[model samples]
Target: MNILVAATSVAAVAFLLLSSNQNIPESVKPGSSAALFALGTAGFLVVSSVLALLRVKFSRWLMLAAALIFFGILGFQSLALLVSSGASLPAGATPKLWANVIRNTLEIAINAWALLSAKASTFFMGNRPNQSSEADGSAAAQL
Candidate 1:
């Protein structure tokens, strides 16, 4: 599950990078890229969530972070689309390109964090069952 999430994150980032290039067709605009990235991110989130619900180790934070990041990007994209269609802002409207760029930046950051966290957790678990068990015991004791 961690591997799957990491792979999807990498693919999502690659898609976003490729779609950002001007050489790409206008049909593959930021919006389309965002949509595709969101799909991949959402898939990862769903899979991770299931794993977490099953009490899978190391997935809790990664899943929550991915979900937040994907939802944030989705929200930003929706707002940009609405604004582009002449939806009025109460005060001043954010520029569409800026909003898109911000969303992409945040999505990248969150994905990277999730990947790193998953990797760290895997490494930590792979070599240290005793440590994990002790930690779990302590946590349970505290509870």
Candidate 2:
């Protein structure tokens, strides 16, 4: 799950940066507020995901929050584009827009499905017994 998040986050940032040189989305145009927000969210996700890979306890929560936020923003942008364009392919919307929306939607679904699972929760929070208490118990038993 962490790997998925990390990979997707990196891909998103790379795509955004590379696309900035060409037919980028209007909402995320350079110098726009949306662009700044998107960049910040992407940065947060990348950092949190790396920390999650390292098994940092606080980073688990951070990654969850960052991923959800990133998904939310992308989902909103995609929906807005579709609705504004009347969901028509020939309605001034480029193929790139459609592709990006589809990709974003898929990422949202997969990440949410993985992140909300019981296994993911356990992985983030851990289920190990307290080794310190066990050690204390053994020492007491010896005494």
Candidate 3:
């Protein structure tokens, strides 16, 4: 799951960065270079995935950090979408906003999924006896 998240993060960031060079996505662009921050976040997420895969003790926190960033982006976009006038937005802003919102939401979900999988187990809870190795574990567990 972490691998999936990491890979998708890379791909998404790449696509956004490349596309933003031509036309900016409303959700990801707080400024001219804000997409660069998204790319940097993706880079961090990839590193955290690698660390979690290797059972690094501190990596779970990194996972949470990335998740928080995704959640913040998604949450803010969702709120903005709820209140903002679609007619006032730029041409194609609606689709770009929706796309970024969905993408960020999915990445947040993947982070949650990875946090419970066997690969990232050591990163969170220590080596305790018999934790369930559920892929998409506990829908209730969110941070």
Candidate 4:
């Protein structure tokens, strides 16, 4: 169980790296693409990490929302690929679409497992009410 959580954590980090290479419109500068990808991927990872660790309802909702977003992107890209004559998009569009589809698909699966699996939910939920309060009280006492 712990191994599973660790695995997902590693995946989150890998996602950071994978996202760095996402395709950007030519109109957007190269530097902006890096920054945008970093921010978006890192932000999602950080938030998702926290949400999963807490094992709150928000985490469940977040997983659902993220899946929807990824699915939407894939759907849009598939549409574009069908209709596009390679005129409007950059030459890299196909690779970019596949890259996104793969990463998003992986993330959606991992997140769903984190949210829905009882073992994962228990692992993330941690020691729950008692542990957090005790730690907080200890810190407060020290302060």
- Against the reference, the lDDT scores of all candidates come to 0.61, 0.67, 0.65, 0.56
List the candidates' TM-scores in order: 0.37, 0.57, 0.51, 0.44
Q: What is candidate 2's CA lDDT for residue 129?
A: 36
Better of 1 and 2 by lDDT: 2
Candidate 4 whole-model C-alpha lDDT, 0 to 1: 0.56
lDDT string, candidate 1, 21-55, tens digits: 66777664447566666567767777776665555
Candidate 4: residue pairs that collide: none
Tens digit of lDDT per residue, candidate 3, span 1-143? 54566567668766765574745646773443665676676677678767766556777778678766756665576659846876787788777877777776776777777676786564456542334344435443432
Clashes of each: 0, 0, 0, 0
Off by over 4 Å in 4: 1-26, 29-45, 70-82, 86-93, 124-126, 129-143
Model 3, residue pairs in steric clash: none
- Candidate 4 at residue 91, lDDT? 77
Per lDDT, the best of the predicted structures is: 2
lDDT of 2 by residue, 11-119 (tens): 7655775674556775563455655665678778888877776667677678778877876677677677777876565755656676767776777677677767898
Q: Can you write out model 4's per-residue Cα lDDT over 32-53, one digit (the tens) per residue?
A: 4654653554455556556656
Candidate 3: list runs displaced more than 4 Å: 1-32, 86-110, 113-143
Candidate 1 stretches with Cα past 4 Å from truth are 1-36, 87-143
Question: Which of the numbered candidates is closest to the native, going by highest TM-score?
Answer: 2
